[model samples]
Target: MLLGLHDHWQELCHCHVSLSIYLGFLGAQGKFAYKLLNDLFANYSNALRPVEDTDRALNVTLRITLSQIIDMDERNQILTAYLWIRQVWVDAYLGWKKDAYDGIDSIRIPSSYVWRPDIVLYNNADEQFTGSMETNVVIRHDGQVMWDSPAITKSSCKVDVSYFPFDGQECRLTFGSWTYNGNQIDILNGLDTGDLTDFVENVEWEVLGMPAKRNVIIYGCCSEPYPDITYTLLLKRRASFYIFNLLLPCVMISFLAPLGFYLPADSGEKVSLGVTVLLALTVFQLLVAESMPPSENVPLIGKYYIATMTMITASTALTIFIMNVHHCGPGAKPVPKWAKKFILQYMARLFFVYEVGETCKSSKRQPKVRVVDGRTEEGGHQPRVCATGLCLCRHGSLLRDVEYVANCFRDQKAAQKRTGEWKKVAKVMDRIFMWIFFVMVFFMSVLILGKAI
Candidate 1:
């Protein structure tokens, strides 16, 4: 029993010794971290740059990763985005030997305790210029400090909306130290291009690329060069939204303007149809204007709407004229000889139009002979002989009465013929104008909208 008790006592002693050693090791690490923090900040000043030599410029490397595109306001010319900003620099006073600190190689500390570069976006448009969230800074034993901050930035961007829904835009985000010149602090790009590995896709825009460039320029006020890093975000509009909502409807409505010519003049709706289409195009133009900025450069879609409205307006006026020509009465003047030859003859033949009961075989048919009051009439002219082969001079009173009635009939027929010729001229003009306007719309659509593709 005593031997067994001795064995149990040995096991307890071994466990107690192991626990004490592990506790001691943990306490030592805690002590080392506390000591390092005190030593680093004891003589350090956050206001001064963390450099060994004041004459030598401190290099701060900057890197940005796009997280999401929040919004792009074309009217206001602003670009809002979420980004991950990383800055790396060396602090000469923050380094320590790992052997003296329980093999501590890195530590996390509040950023306020260390010096950070005053880098800011130069073209910020928001009231609050800086939109970064403060986080802890990582310090390595070799004096390297890394600060990763998440920022939601709103920067000014100049937008060119001439092509509108089919347009691509390039916006730049310029970053540099606000107070430090190139001689005091030099900024460097970690990579040739901005990082986009974690970028969230936007519904209305597609990111073509983001390229970064370093620029050093000297202002007139200061001889020292001010350095800046510019990241250009190249974006293209998706265009599908505008295509369905605005462009397709306008195109369909534009074609309707030409169809107004096909409507009959006597229908009384020809002019009304043209006017309604014109008003619809105007409404569409207003919709486009509401979305775009009030700029001098007109959008491609807006140009099309204006052209369509003009054509519709002209069609309405011509429709009114054609209706007037169709309603010519017996008192109206006869259609000019030129109109009969050009419009009624050449243009009528071109448009495959002819008077009622007139056809290709009508010219070959035999003339009709009519007997009126015993007087035979051949063709359209009255004959001088009676149908019974008797001398018409024996009945002088009856002959005089018949001759007066025949003169009245010829006058009425001549008036009716003049009115028919005028109606035919109006129809031929309508067909010619319809085809002309149709061709105009076709070429206009091809030239203006084709550039988008």
Candidate 2:
């Protein structure tokens, strides 16, 4: 009855020789008798042959062939095998191509612009995905998706995709193929849709070498966005970032924190601004460190951090020096001679004049004021007022208006006196440390910037 029913349908036959495979597997399962039974039942179509079930979607037949898979001790695989798939359609062939430009734009479409579905899937019996630090993309025959590592390599689909990669793009491919025992089935459900518009990306294809193994790994990167979904595969990679862009800015900003040395502690803005910049750099450093891999050797930017912190620490120390000088000091250290004599003269009058001349004559000239009625203008403001400015304004203020001109002159003297006292307080530092630290920081920063350049 089984023979009569099966003979009435179309029969397909393929020989499968599983000598060392299934027998060994059955032996491990304590089912060694199945090997014996298989041998005995080899000639019987009635014993272990197909029993048709009308409920299944695809009809399947099972046959035990009395053959041996070649000993294959010196087996050589075919290096180049064109993929053969039952194609539903074939588009226009790329026989020839021409390159042209519309206006200043380049349009690139060569004879190689032709694409084909040449992806192949081969099974490696030993490769397996373990569910640990690794991940395997899982795609069901029905298209449901999930990811988990399988203990055994029952099935894998190998593809050398040239349709969806670019020079530096990145993408990740997940697997859903899994096997439980030795008899696991790897079904090739096949491509359901073929849409070339689904993937218009850069190509990441390169030939790789494997001596003792067969693999389909070619270099690939992220794919560009497509207009539709057409069974895309991608491999994900962690984005790479430069240490300078990632960290140096914060370190540099932090390094700027110590510049409060120029600020008078008596002014309300000194420590407040310094401490704020310090906190900002610290926070930025912490944030930058989060993106870095853990390493014992500090990054180049980390060295910058240390150096910058050293400079900032020096700046902070100078601020402390200024505070001490303003409050109390020994031997009455004179004010910075440069700040008093040369710096005030050259910087305020000469350097400042040069800067003003450059500002006035430069190509980037903008709106600027020619004079100030005590209300200052932008870009003309300096960090600190020099005694030269006091002297400049001395006779000018002395020539005041008729509205209590004597009182205005007295107030002007008081302001000048305050400026002189501030200078005197600043003079307590032996100008030696300021000049030394300035040159040191300048030289070091320039060296670092040069190296970076």
Candidate 3:
């Protein structure tokens, strides 16, 4: 039993010894990490370019990942976006021996404690031009440093809203070192295009693609070449919002303009309807103007609204003329021969317009038979009839009075007939103009709005 107890004691002692060794090793490793940080920054100069040779140029690889599109100001011609920016470069002064530093292959430190490239957006439109967030730098044992940060970039973009609401835009974001010439620092595109793997989709705009290009230009101020990387972000506007809010309402108003002609002239609402439609189109045009810049190029929807407004104005003027013709009185002049031939006959047939009945014509009064002074005579005149069926009348004061009354009644009947014909001509012309305006509105809408489809 004593031997077995002795064996258990030995095993317990061995475990205690091993635990002590592990705790000591862990403490030593913690001390080494602390010492490593101190040694790395002790002689490091953050302001210098971290290069051993002054003649060799540093190459910086730049990459951007679009995270979100915050806002696009078309009026101001600016694009605001949230981006993930990555910069990689070699810092010859930041290298360390992994074995001497307790096998630590990489380290993370505050970026302010190291020399960094002063890369900036060339087309910045924001008050705070350098928009990168201060982040840590990751340094590997082989003298490579990587910086990953989030940036809110506001860049100037030339806006073309000719097809607006259904338009596509290509905005560019140019990046390069602000103070460094090509001999001091050269910029390189890390990829052919920007990364979209983590992009958050925006409701108003769709990302088509982002392509990067490198340019080297020699400015007149300096003999050294300035290199830059430009990223072109192609975007298409999502038209669903504008279609429901702006376009569909305008189309409804366009259809309403033609309906003004269908209103009866007697109702006295035809001109009012046309004027209301014109006002509605004007309101829509104002809405379009509010969203777009004051540019020379008008939007497709704006053109459509202008055309519709002009049609409504013309329609309103024609409605007034039609009402004038419809209300012709006995004193008004007769409709011309051409108006009767073209509008009353041909146009009436074309528009399928017809009078309700032949009641519009006055019925002729029959001559009364009377016996006066012991003689049978027609009521119209006292005359002696010859064998040729012609009557010769004798002039007298009573006969003259009767002929004058008959002449007045005959002139009244002819005036009433002419007034009716003029009204008929107005009805036919109204129908013809309605169809003409309908055709114009239809073709104009198709030609302009069809581009969206």
TM-score of each: 0.86, 0.30, 0.84
Q: What is the lDDT of residue 239 in candidate 3?
A: 92
TM-score, candidate number 1: 0.86
User: After superposing candidate 2, which stretches have Cα over 4 Å from the reference?
Assistant: 1-248, 251-255, 329-453
Candidate 2 lDDT (Cα, 0 to 1): 0.35
The Cα local distance difference test for each model comes to: 0.86, 0.35, 0.85
Candidate 1 vs candidate 2: which has greater TM-score?
A: 1
lDDT of 3 by residue, 1-453 (tens): 999999999899668754553444356475565567677778888888878888989999999999999999999999999999999999998788989978888777667768999999999999866678977789898989999999999999999999987899999999998999999999999999999999999999999999999999899999999999999999999998998999888888888877887887789889889888888888889988988989999988888888788888988999999899989999999888998889877787778777765232433455775645323457757645445643243336666766777668769878988888988888888888899998998898788667888
**Which residue pairs in candidate 1 have backbone atoms (N, alpha carbon, C) closer than 3 angstroms, thus clashing?**
none
Task: Give the lDDT of residue 251 in candidate 3.
Answer: 83
Best of the candidates, TM-score? 1
Tens-digit lDDT track of model 1 for 1-453: 999999999899668754553454356487787777778778889999988899999999999999999999988889999999999999998899999888999988667778999999999999867668877789999999999999999999988888888899999999999999999999999999999999999999999999999999999999999999999999999998988899888888888887887887778888888888888888889999887878898988888888878888888888789878988988789888888788877788887776667774453255686876656577789666545757655488988887778778878988887887778778888888888888988888787668678
lDDT of 3: 0.85
- lDDT per residue as tens, model 2, 1-453: 889767654242111223433443353332433333343235434221122332322211111111111111111211111111221111211111211111111111111222212222223222342222223222222212222221222223232212111111121112221211111211222333222232223222221211121112212442321111112222221212332454446545654564465555567565566566666656655764564445453544555556666666666666666676565432343446555665434333432222223442443266563334443346667434545755554455544543256557657766654455445445434243445556665665565445433
- Candidate 3 runs further than 4 Å off: 1-29, 358-408
